[model samples]
Target: MRQSKRIAIIAHNNKKRDILEWAEFNRLFLAQHELYATGTTGKLLEQELGRPIHKLQSGPLGGDQQIGAKISTQEIDVLIFFWDPLEQQPHDPDVKALLRIAVVWNIPIACNRSSADFLISSNLMHNEYQPHLPDYHDYLERNFQEHAIQVNRELPFPVGTV
Candidate 1:
């Protein structure tokens, strides 16, 4: 089985409602994929959309760290962070790290609703997504074809040569 790209939804206190609305709008696409979120945002989205979600702590309560770990592990493919640019986050380092990792890893990230909408509305989300559980066999399988071609090119005698 292959793993679907993991997506984490998070929001600042003021943007929670917006995140919920976005989640509700894209529930079908989201439901088929794994959802991780900060505490209040997760609860709210779950209640409004009638969907169960894996909840992490509140962002101020180490939730951002959780996201950072997932991003570093390449477990999180998209980060929908609805942040309030005006608010001063006490855990600023966590926020910085989360965004930094998202950039460093080249994974898609959305800091506002506009970007979030663009991401969820992408063809990748609209099409059917095969759920990959626990193992990333599918991701590996998808990459294998390219790797095989590269391997063949690098071999002086061509691949599978005696």
Candidate 2:
């Protein structure tokens, strides 16, 4: 049996067409996987592709954070985000956070059509591949251990907050 992946799809307002077109072109390939997307994008994609897509809130309305949380919990396997760099967005921070979480989780992410093509076409997609994920528990434990010596010491504002 082929390994079916959980793919998260997102697109900025201006890039929706491009993402839709890309998804249409990759219909068969995408049909083999589980699909998820933000509200508006998911609706559009469902309308265009005629496929079932799990829909979350709109990006600016907490969808990005939802996806980020999914990444942190290892629920998502791939991300296809066609963001528009030419335009500024009100939810830019959320977008960046989502991308950062994907990176930290060590999942495959595609920010454009070329990369998406490569990711989907890769032979690894059909197989069970283990990614080198950061040991977050170990990292937190190390931090706490390093700070154990300063337990009695009062600090100023937290580091990097100033």
Candidate 3:
């Protein structure tokens, strides 16, 4: 990741105020990095920070998936998602997938204000850091080979003759 990290911020309905407060407190540091957020959150942040934010759809409207895609493509370096754990979200699967993808891509994630503070304040945040990416090539190859074997066994014709 670059010194100027690409940070994605998200907040549940119940956590919006908290996120806004946390964001306002770190406005100066946040201004130095690239900012992204869901629809409503992005608008609020832009107004609060007086800067541009890359806004996507609302969280329930596919914003989480969009952020997941960015994480997979290495477009986003950090995720500050203040999700409401007690409240059940209608789009829970998407939220889960977003978290899964972040882990898969080995990006830093902050689920609450305390964690966000720790993450943002870390020395690594200001330096060019390379995160460890999980190796999936072997897993992919193994699955493909297994599928081929299964297909061969299911075939009606003899292996050499077919």
RMSD in Å for all candidates: 9.8, 5.0, 1.6
- Each candidate: how many clashes? 2, 0, 0
Q: What is the descending lDDT order?
A: 3, 2, 1
**What does candidate 3's lDDT look like per residue over 1-162, in tens digits?**
899999999999999999999999999899899999998999999999999999999999999999999999999999999999999999999999999999999999999999999999999999999999889999999999999889888989756884
| Model 3: pairs clashing at backbone N, Cα or C within 3 Å | none
- TM-score, each model? 0.73, 0.89, 0.94
Cand. 2 Cα-lDDT: 0.91
Which candidate number would show the highest TM-score if scored against the true structure? 3
Q: For candidate 3, what's the RMSD?
A: 1.6
Question: Model 1, range 79-162, lDDT digits (tens) per residue?
Answer: 999998998989888899889877766677889989988987777655544433345568789799889999888888886667
Question: What would the TM-score be for candidate 1 when compared with the true structure?
Answer: 0.73
Best by lDDT: 3
lDDT of 2 by residue, 86-160 (tens): 999999999999999999989999999999999999999988887787878988988997886475345565555
**TM-score, predicted candidate 3 vs. hidden true structure:** 0.94
Residue 129 of candidate 3: its Cα lDDT? 97
